[model samples]
Target: MTDAPGSEGPEPSEPPTSRREGGGLRRAHSAADASASTTTGARSARAEFETHVAHARAEFEEANERIKQRTGRDLILAIVIGVAIGVVVVASLIFFKWIFLLFAIAATSLGVFEFVRALRASGRRVDLIPQLLGGVVLMLSGYFVDLWLHWVLTMVVVVVLIVWRLLGQMFSRDGRTYGAVLSDVLITGLVVLYVPFLGSLAMILLSQDGGEWWALAFIIITVAADTGAYVTGLTIGRHPMAPRISPKKTWEGFGGAFVAALIAGVLLALYMLGLPWWTGLIIGAVILGTATIGDLGESMVKRDLGIKDMSSWLPGHGGVLDRLDSILPSATAALALFYLLSPLAVS
Candidate 1:
């Protein structure tokens, strides 16, 4: 037993080796020396462990400081650029219908470009020109025609791309690998769907009578959800929503998104889009679900390609795809709702 602090106790003493005349004295000295050695070693090891822990803590803090310094300017720049884009898009939708379509084409083209660049970075061979041409055609077709003709034009573009790929294979000996050619064809189709095909939905929405308001409502609800998630996640996020996919996203953030989206949906539906409050609530929920999936989908792509951002096109935004990740899937949902509950149907 050991003595308790503040209690009267004998001070521990080492048996003198010089008094090792008897067998009992020698044993006492040996036991004392052994105990003293063990205590010293344990203290030394504990000191070493604490030193290592302190060093690690300092390094972590330094890295965090560096990241904070770097992102400070980029964050401000990204916000400024984002606000400018929102104003331009809203203005175009209000005054110039043709300008809106042109903007969509440009954005769709850039989206295709970013996708091809990411594929190339991953050593995937993609025919850029054919995919680019196909994206433009897909957008123009959707903008000009009804839903039925839009599907026909989509098939026509796909067939043309198939022939275009075959012609390229015939011309280039090095591009004749069966696996590479197959990958190129599939990737071309994906680029179309991922960027232009889904993107054309925006044009479809805008072409309808009083469709600009519908388009604006969609944009506002989606943006609100994103903002809510980001702010909530940063403030109180603890449990990760998808740790393997997006470690930063949390269930708490999703809850925040749901609340914000619901409010935005109800208000926009009642005032802007001429729908009931209940309809807006449903739309908000749908958009939130689709937008979350879209963000995860892009994260999956980045994980597969072994790259951080698609490209450094936008400073803090990463790339066009990064910004459009939530928008594309939400756009598809919005388009479906428009068809089912056409705002123009009542009139």
Candidate 2:
């Protein structure tokens, strides 16, 4: 080939670009370098992305582990408290006929206080006087509810609440009205009376019946139901029953509770309480239904207050009220059923 431009004969082998114009070869070299740099940058970005993902995964795992640890601790605490209180109550029943009734009244009072506090926390005003009056009336009438006082006290509650609301509006502050006061009073009365007041019936049944096997049976079945639901919910719950109110409650857990409650009933009745299978089954059904109702009721309360968990008073259980809320209704219903059907009713 002829010498390229000024180059001598047998021109040096230039790259394809410079072969035509040396400038072309220079541009080609630069393009290759730029492309290699871009590729290297892409690799570096990918590497950084992987590192970030690993860090996020580690944090997530750590959080889950901490949650699990807290859960285990709470469960242990619940068992201890339940066992201790149950032991004390059982021991007292031997020496006192109505000690648990006093306990029930005290619990009702405390529960009422807790409820009102929740209301106030949620930007609602609840005059303590009327609520306390209603609560006291409800408590006193607890004994006579099976007879004549229950309906009367309920009527009184309704009336007092209505009057309280009228008085409250008349005494409005800075154009603010206590319009919800009436509803609050009425609902609180019903909850305190029906839940804790009537719950005293369980105590009456056990202490007065000359046999506490039934009470023990109730404790066992309900405890089993609670345990089963909790355990199964933690592991296998997929479909939520009430996602907004109780995210943890699920159909799968409920089914597990039903089965566990039935098993608990069978064990308690046949082996411990020495009752017939039919009776055991009946008790199990009652426990299952009441357990669900109690849970739903408490869930409703917490939801109304725009809060999660009644309080963190009881490490694992949320609050004293939360833990006792379900049991109150369940205990009351069990006793009422006993008074109507059990051998204790023969008297």
Cα TM-score per model: 0.76, 0.68
Name the candidate that leads on lDDT: 1
| RMSD, every candidate, angstroms | 17.1, 15.8
**Could you give candidate 2's per-residue lDDT for residues 1-347 as a string of tens digits?**
67577676675784565356877778888999999999999999999999999999998768656545734435546668878877766665556645655666666666767777887788666666676667666655655345355666666775776567567756776466345655555655565465545554564555534446666667667778888887787778788888877777888888889999988887766776556666778788797788788888888878878887666666656766776666777776677656654662223
Model 1, 58-77: lDDT tens digits are 99768655544633325456
RMSD of 2: 15.8
Model 2, stretches more than 4 Å misplaced? 1-73, 144-146, 172-174, 177-182, 185-194, 200-213, 271-274, 343-347
What are the lDDT scores of the predictions, listed in order? 0.82, 0.69
TM-score of 2: 0.68
